[model samples]
Target: MVSAENSSLEYLRSLVNYDINSILYDDTLICSLTNNTDVGSFEVKVTKTNYGNLHDCIQVIANSQATIDGVACGTTVRAVVTRELVTVQQEHTEYVKLPNPITRIVDFISESTDYVITITNEEGKKKTTETKRIPKNEAQGLILEGANLILQRLMIQRNMPDKVTMLSLDSSSELSRNVYTSLGPQQVNINGKDIEAWGIQRQIFETKPNALPIAWQSFFSIDGHLISRYQVGSPIKMKTRNIPEAEQFDEYLPKPEIPKRELEWENDLELRSRFIDRRDELIDDYKSYIYQHPDINALLSDFLQSVLITKPENIIDYATEFFAPFNNQTADRSLFRFADEKIPVPKPNISLK
Candidate 1:
């Protein structure tokens, strides 16, 4: 006789089985970022190809690329296999070339008892680890499969508990149970049509009870597909779109370059903390630009600030609107005006006309 916990675990394991034939048939999906306050608007295209053979062992291959501010930030590819309702023998690579160039490659090969993870980065950095044998019910490996796996797990346990612990391949922290509160059926307007989906409040990272919860939310379909996601109270919502072929994204994937500086940071806690603070400050500076020009889409700032050639007319109206409120001629205008035509009209008719 199976206990309730065991039964639930078994059900969770079944949903994550990588051998799900329907999901592997040369599929393409487009996910686009949507929001007014979003720092950057981006799109991700994922493609999956299936190689149906036993000897190949590398049964499924998935490729994903994300572009932010009209530039390719990174590309990831994964080769995954399934055995006994568990995804194993994953080969993965992350190529990042935006802001800086970095390449991270991970290979996980299954042994009799456990799996070994070998990682290599662009700077000739390498690290290897042996993972404990994952139980049938556990979750691990590439996000292409892990996302769907976790979604299925959450859908199954939606009514059971508000918080549940799950395993992960990440080494920064131990496996922790994340709190999830259902927002119930939300009416999502997609492409001008209303579709009902379940909303779940998620903690993007672990935080103390008294500390602020970095709120992230995901909306899932009745069939447990993630249709949309965003930070709570944020206007930005990333939604899914249909794609004809995965090859459509090939042109957008840029070749990665290695940076000159040492990419690896030394093990210094205080220095790391200060570095994190500096990083946040840089982000705050980016936010200042957006805050100053609220009418302009934040995504356009990259083009306005970086590109040598631009249609200034496209952004001139936004700049005019942003400064219109502060247009008053508070300062002495007579001393500064070379042509009198540049003077303010509202303030004592300073204009010569």
Candidate 2:
């Protein structure tokens, strides 16, 4: 008789064989570098492919138009493993073509259990380094990049309790293990609708004594969609109201144009001019880092000057993306408060003063 755990792993293997193990999700997420949110999208494809003698392949690509470290960046990560999901190969590339041109590509190959990492520079120079052999469990469970959907699926499939230690493939270092504690299932409201989700806490610990671990909480829907994610120290959040079906969107379509009129504050001529001017300034400085930049005070001063402009009712929807790097709710409220102060109301022609 096959155990439930074995049955779950077997089911995952079957999905890989038919190339049905894939997910596409879109979201607005905060960038840690800019401290602002953007229309971030993630696509993950896992298929059965023949890479040398290995056949399982996993690819993750993420893109955001927001600036990171003073540059617009996008990343694609590819990982190949055996049927059991043990690492056989991994590769990552980061491309930044706006404001500045920068590209980094690295490859990791597993040979006799040890990993050899090779990095290629723009000059085509190659550097190679080696890391000690990773444990089979760590290699099998390493998450290169993607939604928590995969992890959540496995957790629920196996009925795992307590915590699970999964390796984070963010870096080649062996210390990137993320320990996730399952908080069980909870009910949450999404888009004014109630839904049941699995809440999980992810923590990254350091080898140093008494050091604080980077931690965050993530929630996934029963159908394996990552619905919400929150981190400490910042009120920023990431959520997807719906999980998109595969191939529902076309990738080669022409990019849509931004609506100029939507941002124009026409009710007040002065407000309209100021709002338009500020929007132009932000577009000009789109490449600049918003979080603790070298001239942060000057940048904030200029940004504060624009706060007096009359904010549109839909400002919250635009502020998260337009503010580029400001705290989301804070920026939204400041605009609202500024609008309240500037817009005067006549009280039925009655004066009390």
Candidate 3:
């Protein structure tokens, strides 16, 4: 005669073959017993794959109608268990088209005689007319480099400058007193190579009173005909924002002065332990609050569902790609490899008595 344990084991083994094995990296497990007979209670054991180690094994009390087979079976019994996976693979791909380059230069004059340059190319066009405060000695060189850098940065932001190199500032001459006297091209050594460089000559002037002067000059390139020339100087007036005055906290009270204190070396371990304990307490409190507030949980679930449903797939792709570099293996495993192993399913255990 087959014993009840043997029969139950056999039944469980058969059910394991037919029961759908779902791969849920991080999800909740829901189990419901619709029918049973002569069963007072049941035991379930969960094991980890690859390791074959027992994760959790426990027995659940049967309900009023629940039974081993059918006699002691309960009307309806349900169990929900949630497990968190250490690693997960979420794949995403994005297709981007490159932009054109600037072929023409556009001139923009500010209200205060500040000249700005905009370049248009095959891929796209970029313009910068606002005057940026720059040191007089490095103004021209920075203007050349900064403008191109700004455009390149913008293209990078737009995800356009892929596999293409644009003309940019290679080297610049420093401002010197000699620049005021010498009107000829200056010999500069750049990257272990001596080259005759030219552009606008930079000179320091005492009369200008906090202003630097840059004189337009010519450079002798390897091919010879002066490649670039520009003169940059101080602006007559800088633009500023109008901020409203903040209201005084006390109309007549005098402002209090704070006394500075010297640094002290307290017990770091104790401090850290206190902080961690406080943090854990706060987190536990929050979880308890959430558990007590079923309405809030329902509202949150609804909000999350709505967000996931209404979010554009492309925007998610873009955001994922943008943050892919920063996420760790647990967060962004898909970015690094194709055949990464899936996270193992956690065993179900009795978390509460």
Candidate 4:
């Protein structure tokens, strides 16, 4: 029961069948088990309430067994999605004790800052945590497979979307495809107790970019609990089930293997519609450089302000006097002091004609 005086979130509040505000505090821990996939069985523990410093954001932690180049490997993924107007950001990460093959990271470009935390234990061992200040545009169409609840609002409203592209992180690589959605009646039975649910079917298109889509269905209880998931004719079933000791390795799984310097896109569009191949180091350098100087940022900001405010024709000459008195000097520190000091605008030389 949350109301917004600003009405910014009132619309979102109305759209969701369940309480958005209360969902963040629900103590229920939902777990899903996926078995018999090409790789192996995996368990995912979903925390709807709290997972990180960003209170009330969505978090998904998955533990699984995978094979890379035919060798068995254990994998873990902790994906954090900070709430936005529509989509969310996955730019925040903390320390992990175990090793993994890959971890997908996405960023929205902007001025940035990084804060690193290190803790030393009595045994002289240290654990490090990392955080950053990031805010940017909400990615409109991209979706996460593990946190499909992001679509709960639309699902409850019975307004399923179609022809949208979908993206997900697998144990070792990324999986993506075009998709379409449809709604239907569903009756789920757990040990013979039938529970009414909403059946949302999705057709995933990897071949021909959707000429033929593989049928996938997700069933949710009326109150929006993901009760079960099934691919049309596949034996792999993912539903709310307990897999003991799975959540224990959430933080201690092996560190992710650094992706190759070059990226291998699943399709051509994915390859062309990207910026850098892999430049985390360069991005860190950029944030570090910008964080070092707040004064310079202000100085340039004022210069640009004066440029627009004055609208001087000879911009180079105007900038020269924007902070009037070239040398370190008198009290005329005013930006566009020429205007503030009542300096006259340039008068054009016109001979009497």
Q: What RMSD value applies to candidate 2?
A: 29.3
Better of 1 and 3 by lDDT: 1
Report the number of the highest-lDDT candidate: 2
TM-score of 1: 0.44
Full-model lDDT for every candidate? 0.48, 0.55, 0.30, 0.46
lDDT of 2 by residue, 35-58 (tens): 545534444454455677554443
20-51: candidate 3 lDDT, tens digit per residue:
12211111111223331122322222222321
Write candidate 4's Cα lDDT for 151-237 as tens digits: 543454444443333433222212334244556667776545677767777654443332445676777655455566656765446
Query: What TM-score would every model get versus the actual structure?
Result: 0.44, 0.47, 0.15, 0.37
Predicted candidate 4: what Cα RMSD to the true structure? 28.6
lDDT of 1 at 71: 56
lDDT of 1 by residue, 216-235 (tens): 67765654455566556644
Q: What TM-score does structure 3 among the candidates reach?
A: 0.15
Model 3, residue 201: what's the lDDT? Answer: 37
Error of 2 at 240 (Å): 1.2
Candidate structures ordered by lDDT, highest first: 2, 1, 4, 3
- lDDT agreement of model 2 with the native: 0.55
